[model samples]
Target: MGESVKYYVLLILRGMAMGAADVVPGVSGGTIAFITGIYEELLDSIRKIGPNTLKALLNEGIPGAWRQCNGAFLASIFGGIAISMVSFARMITWALENHPILVWSFFFGLVAASVVYIFRQLTSVSWREIMALAIGLGLAVFVSVARPVALPDYWWVVMLSGSVAICAMILPGISGSFILLLIGIYPVFIGAIESFNLPLIASFLLGCGVGLLAFSHVLSWLLKHYHNVTLALLTGFLMGSLNVIWPWKQILETTVDRHGEVIPLVQQNILPLTYESLIGLPSQLWPAIGVMFLGLFLVLGLEAISNNMSRCE
Candidate 1:
């Protein structure tokens, strides 16, 4: 019993790490899962909750279906994610508001290390794989810099946003919330969460369910058949995502939110000295660099531990 409790607790901690990563704009929960050695398992579990599992529920009963779907594992991981999102939403928001540069610097380092880590997974490199990497890198860079579209507040739009965002959530270098922000529904979704808008939440969740089921199957298939190319592409994605998280930036455009607060909409990356000269901000160069190193080492340490455990097992 104690062993069971201990195992589940560890799962919860992994989920928490995922949740924290998801909260960051340029980070991905899937990155956490990958680092923690649960990426494939998580994908498999998600993929199982489809037609076969439903059929099992009807034919063999709840126990069989639950077992087939790995219900306990899913529950533990998702429960931790939910808890972390709810618990840290406001705190993360506050941190972003007050310490944007430092926050971005940390995630920037995290993703830079992630690119190297993911790249090492490739056993061989080919021209086609290199092309795939370029494509992925281009796509990520484009998405990172693309301007936000003003989406309507309609239910369908919200649902579509959720569907798309959840896909990004599961990708190693793409961020779901950042996708939402790009589509101009991030504030609305955040507001919905804060207000407990049941209908909006339901619609969004429905979209997420559909998206996750569909995307996981496609991803699982690709990983099974074309592992090298896929990893190459994902590594490229991490490489391009660095542009999104660069620490020093100048806001080129701003928009008024619902609260009438001016929020940065478009930004240009700049050197620390340039940022100081142009924006007249303190730049916080030393602190940001320190945090960046902390994030880099954190990923390295986790990778070392994961490797050690694999060897022991």
Candidate 2:
């Protein structure tokens, strides 16, 4: 017996969800992978994509190399992510620009539910795991609040930022886009994307490939040896990251980009009514809450389906 086509389709859908999450600044594709019940397998698959696969290709042929690299799964997942990022990028960008609070509110619920789901994976709540969770939480908060540091517009710097940000992107709680923002290169990258600068795009993507390969190995090893601590730390990362996506926020400062577009440079979460009063905009409190529940139930529903499938297997 083998996996049905339906299984692969589901995997693609899961990948799409991860892609959608990645498009949001405060959310993570890795967190989406974790909540969708494929975190370990995804890590393992990424870790296996290395030099050995080439040797397998020479010795055992393309199929052998593919098997060694788990090509089918990677292809399905990455393909779906590609499709989704392309399809949803415009829509999400529009939503965030026009309905920022509502958009963030939905993801707020999604990530909140994710914290509970990931925490439930722990078999026990020991002191060591507790410490790990605290550290992860602190790190997430620090990163969320950190001010942007502007680097020179150099190619090597772009590559370095890509490598470092890619590491954060794959981590469960961190946001690669937000990390880029904190690095003060997000707008440049966006400009490149808009202009289709092949050289810059290639540099960044090359960095991403290198970083993903390197970090996946380290993360896979950590999960294998210290599952409890790592899982707990990841759960904490999710908990702390809620600050990044809080629905109501007060903009403390704004900056003008190279394109002359103004964007938030500093912000702090605020209560809904306080946000309305301070920002002089409708908090849309009821609509925000409803969307939050929608996002929450969506994750729960997916988790239930995943659990049922696991039992069937």
Candidate 3:
């Protein structure tokens, strides 16, 4: 592919990866983008739809905003995300249901690879940045470890759930679904999806849309002015997220909400582990290790191809 086309293609692939990550409860596509070094560009490009675009929309309408916002990039990346999520959602749901080990193995690989990719990008890390990374990682790990709970079922509760979940959706390392779970709304949102409850879904999407636009700009500004600090925090987030993706824990029973729908809860360390392990072999731990390596390698492989293409250009 030509250089421009190649770059756009990478963006789409990243979008797909993000879609896959977001499909799971703990992973964030934002984290994948951050690890792959496209997070800032992704945010900046999205943030291009600023005051001018709004003004134009007020005056000349959608077309003006379309032109001002570099609609092609948005169309491509978000389009990729939409396509991947819609197309793969069923398959992913099944895999998580039937073959949890193999599925999480792959994610383990993806995240491991992504961390390496991010680390490689950082030429030097100061203690301050390291501290930021640590903070991010710590927070992510905490989220991963928390127990899931029953959610509220009121309209106002739904609105609040939308706002909070949307924030996690935009931020790297956080899972929107998990955020819903934290707020005790996972079952509520899942019910909306299952029952095709349009009003409920619409309310949630409205919150997501508003949250996404607002958060994207704030993140864009942070990356613009405080690049290293932002990256550090994101790195911490990725590290912390490992707790959620660890593949062998057995789910305890489930809890039902006010609606009496059951949601699974988990307890940790159901499998054997040792310092020495191999790709999903000998035990579940090995597979998790292997998958983590695979994740890391995938990111590095893409980076290598990307860097070579830039050189050729």
Best by TM-score: 1
Shift of residue 59 alpha carbon in model 1, Å: 2.5
For the record, the alpha-carbon RMSD of candidate 2 to the native fold, in angstroms, is 1.7
Candidate models: Cα lDDT each: 0.87, 0.87, 0.72
Candidate 1 residue 132 Cα shift, in angstroms, is: 1.5
Q: Judge candidate 2 at residue 228 and give its lDDT.
A: 96
Candidate 3 local accuracy as lDDT? 0.72
TM accuracy, model 3: 0.83
7-39 per-residue lDDT for model 1 (tens digits): 678788889889888877778898888877788
Better of 1 and 3 by TM-score: 1
Question: Which pairs of residues collide in model 1?
Answer: none
Where does the lowest 10-residue lDDT sum fall in candidate 3? 273-282
User: What order do you get sorting by TM-score, best first?
Assistant: 1, 2, 3
